[model samples]
Target: MTICTRFLNQSRLWKWSVLTVAVVGFPWGVGTSQAGFIGGEGTDNPSRQLKALFAEYWDDELRAGPLEATFLGDHRYDDRLADLSDAAHEARVKRDRDHRHALEKIAPETLSADERIDREVLRFTLDDRIEGERFRDRLIPITQQDGIHLQFAQSVNFHPSATVGDLENYVRRLHAFPRVVDQTIALMRQGMAEKRMPPRITMAKVVPQLRDLAPKNPEESPLWGIVAKLKDWSEADRDHATVAVRQAIADKVSPAYAKLAAFVETDYLPACRESVGLWDSPEGDVHYAFRARSFTTTTLSPEQIHEVGLTEMARIREAMEAIRKKVGFTGDLKAFFQKLKDDPKLKNQSEAEILGRYRAIFEAIDAKLPDLFGHLPRTDYGIRPIEAYRAKAAAAGYYYPAPEDGSRPGYFYVNTSDPTSRTTYTMQALAYHEGVPGHHLQFSLAMEVPGRPAFRKFGYVPAFSEGWGLYSEGLPREVGLYTDPYAEFGQLEYSAWRAGRLVVDTGLHQKRWSRDQAIAYLEENTAVPRIEIVSEVDRYIAWPGQALAYKIGELKIREIRAQAERRLGTKFDIRAFHDRLLSLGSVPLSVLERFMEQNQQTEAEPQR
Candidate 1:
C-alpha cells in the first residue's frame, strides 16, 4: 500500500501490532562498523571480489564514447561518440538488468556500509529502469526541446579554442554530427509510433534552429568558427581538418538536418499530442505521482506538493518585495521587475564577458565558504560556455561532474546564448548553485567520501542532489555571508525561482495547465525574461515532475537543519552538522533524519 493509504488506515490498525520486516543486520549489512565484507582486508578496502568488480566497471565505462568520457573526465574516449542506435539502448538496459540480477544473489548482510549503500542505489536504479521500460515510453517521442539541433550550437559556442588539438576535436566531432542526428531521428520515429510526439509548438521551434545551423555555404556554418581559430596549426593539418569538417557538414550534417526538419515539420507535427502532461498517457498520472515520490524521496501527494509550492511562492514574493522597498523603488514589485528586465545595463557585452563575471562570482563566494562550510570539494572547477546547439533550449546553467581519476576538472557550463537574458543580480546565486556550494561541491565531495562504494559516491537521488544545491544557496546567509543586499536579493530571486518551479511543474502536470499559462505564471511571479520562461515551461512539459524536486528537497533539508539546531542548541556545531551531511553523500530524507538523530545522541553524550 502507498504511505497515504497506510496513514488513512492507521486508525483501524491495532496500536501494538507487530509484523516482521526485512532489516539489514551484522556482516550482511554495513552499519556503524566500518568492517569490510566478503573476504576483504581492511574495513575501507572492499572484498577482493568487489575490487575486481570495481576495476571491471571502470574499464567498461571508460570505453564509452569520447563525449561521455570527456564529460566523465576520461580523455581516452575523446575520439569516439555515443551510440544512439536501438541496439545500444538495448545493450544499456541488458547491462543494468544483468548487474541487478548479479547483485541480488549477494546477500546484503555480507556488505560493508559503503557497499550496502552502493548495492541499494544500483538495485533502485535498475528497478526504476525495468519499471520505466514496462511503460514503453517510446510512444512519446520528439519534444521540440531535445534533438541534435541544440547540441551542435552548443559545440560551436564552447568547443572552439586556441589549441590545435582542441580545434581538431571540435571539427572531428562536427564531422560525425550527421550520423548522430540520424540516430536521434530514428529514436524519435520509434517514439512517434508509440504516440510520444513532442508538442507541436516545441517542434515548430526546431525548424528555425535547423535553418540557422544548416548554412548553404559550409564556411558560414558554426563548424567554420573552429576553422577561424586554427591560426597556429601547420598548413597541412589545418587544410586536412578544414576539408574533413566541410565534407562532413555538406554530406552528413546538412542532409541529416533536412531529413529531421522534414520529419518534424511534415510527419511528426500532425501526430503530436495536445495534452500538456504525462498524466494523459496510459497510467500517466500514476507514473507522475510515482516519479514525484521518487524524486522528493517523500510521501507527498500532488495536492500537498501543490499547496507547499503555493506557500513558498507567497513567502518568496514577500521577501522580494522587501528588497524592492529597501532599494527605494517608488513602484510596486512587479514594476521593479519590469524595470530590471528592460534596463540596458543588465545585458553582457558578449559570452566571454559573461564567463568572466561568473568566474568573479565564484572567487567572491569562495572567500566566504570557510565561514559556513566545514568541508569543501577537493576537485578544481572551471567555467565554460554551453555549446550553441543546446544553449537555446538548455537551462541557464548546469554543472558537470569531474573525472573520477582527477585528470579533468568539474565544469560549470553557463548559457550565455541570449546576453540580454543574463542578468548580474542572478549570477551570485547561480554560481553558488551550479559551482561551489551547489552541485560541483556536493557532487565532487560525494565522489571523494572515503569508505563509500563507487555507486553511492556517484549516485543521485534528485531530491537528495538537487535538494542539497537548493539548500546550499540559503546556507551562506546563515553563515554570516551575503552582506551585500543586492546579493541577498539575488539569493531571494534564486529561492523564488525554485519555489516557482514547484508550482509550475505541478501546475502543468497535475492541474493540466497550458504551456502559455505556465510561462505567464513565471513572468508574473519572478523577474526572469519572457523568452526564458517560455523555454523553461517547455522543458517542464518535456520532462514532467523534475522541476518540483528543487523546492521540495530544499524545504526538507532546511526543515531538518532547523530541527537539528533546535535540539542540540549550543552543542550544535555547524561545521560538524555539515560534515555529517556531506559525509554520507546523497541519501534519502529518511536516512538523513536518522543521521541527524544519531548526531544529536552523540552530542548529548559526555566527552571522554
Candidate 2:
C-alpha cells in the first residue's frame, strides 16, 4: 500500500503530492532561478515553461513537507517534521490553487504529446486537491490504520543513518516531535468541536498503539533503532549519539506521545462517534462520493461499484471452487475456508520460517521476471518482519519503495505477530503481490524512469499502483508459478479477498452496513483468517473507498490487455506490453487507457 499519511486531509492528490516532492535549493514561490527558466528560453517553448513550473512546485512542496523530502532521498530537510498547523494547511491549499492557475495558462494544443499528458495529470491533481479543501478529513487525522503518531514513530526506518550528521539530524527531528503532537491535538480538538471524528471503535485501537510507542524506558522506543544502526561508527561517536538520542526520546518524544495518548483516552475517545461509516460525519456523503472517484479514478458511483464488486465476487468464486475440488475437498467453499485455516500444514512454523519462505519465493519469482517484462528495476528489495509495536494492527504484508538515490532498498514488511494466523498457502501470492513483479517492481521502476518530472517519478495513483499489484498476483501463473493446488487456491483466495473488499468497503461506507455485516461478508466469501477479516473490515471503515482500487484497477488493466492481445493476435508480446504499461509510470486509469490505445494504433501502422 502507498503510505497514506493523514497529516493533512487532502485525498489522492495530497497522498501522492506529499510523497513526490524533492529537494531543490530554490526558495518557495517564483524564485530568481524559476523566473529565469520561465522568462528565458521558456518564453517560446511551452514544454520548457511547464517543466519549469513543475520544478517550482516540487521545491515548494519539499519545503512544506520535509519528511517527504527525506523519504525521497533528499536529506536537506531531515531535521524538520511536517507542520500540521492550520496555517500550514491553508498555505498548502493556496499553493495548489496557484499551481493550478499557472497550469491553466498553458495551451495544451501547442505542447508535445508527452507534455500534454503531464499537463492533464497536473490539472487533475490540482483540481482534486483544491476540491478536497472543503472536506473535514484533516480534523479526524488519527485512525486505526494511519495517522501522525504512527508515521512519526516509524519514520526512523526511512532516515539516513550512514553518518554522524545523519544521527544529529534525527536528534533534531526527535526534539521536534512534541510540537507536531501538539499540532495534531489542536486538530483533533477542532474535529471534536465540529463533531468530525473517527469511529469510536477504531479510535479504541489507537490508544494502545500510542501507549506502546511511548514506553517509559527510552531505549525501548522504536526510535532507538536509529542508534542501533550505527554499526560502523567510532565507539565515541556512537556512544555520544546514543546519549543524545536517549535524552531526546526521554525528554521530548515519550512525553509527547503520552500526552497525545491522554488526550485520546480521556477526551477524544469518549467524544468519537459510535458510527463506523463516513456517512455519519459532516459532509460524509459528498466526501465518500469524492473518495470513490479519487481512489478509483473512474466515474462509477458507489451503487455501480458495489454491483461491479458483486459480479467479480461471483466470477472469482467459480474459479476458487474449481481449485477446492482439484484438491479433493468434498466440503463446500465455507467449509474449505475453515479447513485451510485449521490445517497445520498451511500455517507458518515461525517468524524466521515466514521470512525465509518469503525470501525464497521472491528469489524464485525474480528468476522468472525476465520472461514477462522487458525491463526490471535496478533497485533491490528486502523482506523484514513488521516491527513488533505496530504488527498487531498492520496488514499481512506491505511494500515501501526504495529511495531514488539508492540510499536504501525497498522493503517488504511481513506481519509475523501471530504466526498461526498467517497461512503458508497465501505466502506465495503475498510475496508476489508485495515484493517481486508487484509493488516493488512497479514503484521502484517508476522512480527510476528517465526524463520524467519528479512528481511523475515518485507520485502514486492508488488504482494504478494497487491495481497492478492485484494483477501481478495472477501474472506469475503464466510463467509456471503457483503450480501447487493449495498455492493456486491461495492466489484465488487473495483475488477473492480483493474482490470482497469492493463489496465490504462500499457496504460499510455507502450502504450503511454495520461493522459486523462487513466482517460477515468477508468471512463467508474468502478463505482469509478471521483475525485478518476483522482487521480488513476495520481498515475499510477507517479508509473509505481505498480497498475498491485493487479490484477496480485490476479489471481495467485486464480489459486493456485483452484488447491488445486480440488486436495483435499471434504478434502480441507480453514483455513489451508490460514494459510500455510501467514505462508511463503512475498515471490515472483514463490516461493509461488513452496511451495504450495510441500505442496500439502505432503498432498497427503499415510501415515504420
Put down candidate 1 lDDT per residue, 1-608, tens digits, no spaces. 00000111111111100111011121123232322222233233335445444433333433433343344333444444566677876776666565566556666677775666566555665566666676655444334454346545434433435455665666567667777777777777777766655566666767766776777778767756767767788898788877877887787667777777777778777777787777777677787787677667778988789889889989998998898988788998889889878877766778888988887778877888777678888888888776665578667887766656665577787888978677777777777777878877777787787655444555556677678888777777775667767677878877887888888888887888888888888888888878778877887887677677788878888887888888878887787777778777777766667667777777778889
RMSD of 2: 2.5
TM-score of 2: 0.96
Residue 121 in model 2: lDDT: 83
TM-scores for the candidates: 0.81, 0.96
**Which stretches of candidate 2 lie above 4 Å from their native place?**
1-32, 35-44
Error of 1 at 558 (Å): 1.3
* lDDT per residue (tens digit) for residues 1-608 in model 2: 33333332334234364233334442223455575343343455677679888887776777786776776667788999988888888888877877887888899998988889888888888887777778867887778677778878777877878888889899999999999999989999999999888898988999999999999899999999998798899999999999999999999999999999999999999999999998898888888998999889999998899999899999989999899888899989999998998999899878988988988898899999999998999998888888888777788888877776566678888899988778999989888888889988888888777777777777777888889999999999999998898999999899988888888888888899999999999889988999898887888888888888899999999999999999988888999999999988777899999999899878967784
Regions of model 1 farther than 4 Å from truth = 1-66, 75-80, 138-180, 216-238, 330-332, 342-353, 405-408, 450-457
Q: Rate residue 414 of model 1 by lDDT.
A: 83
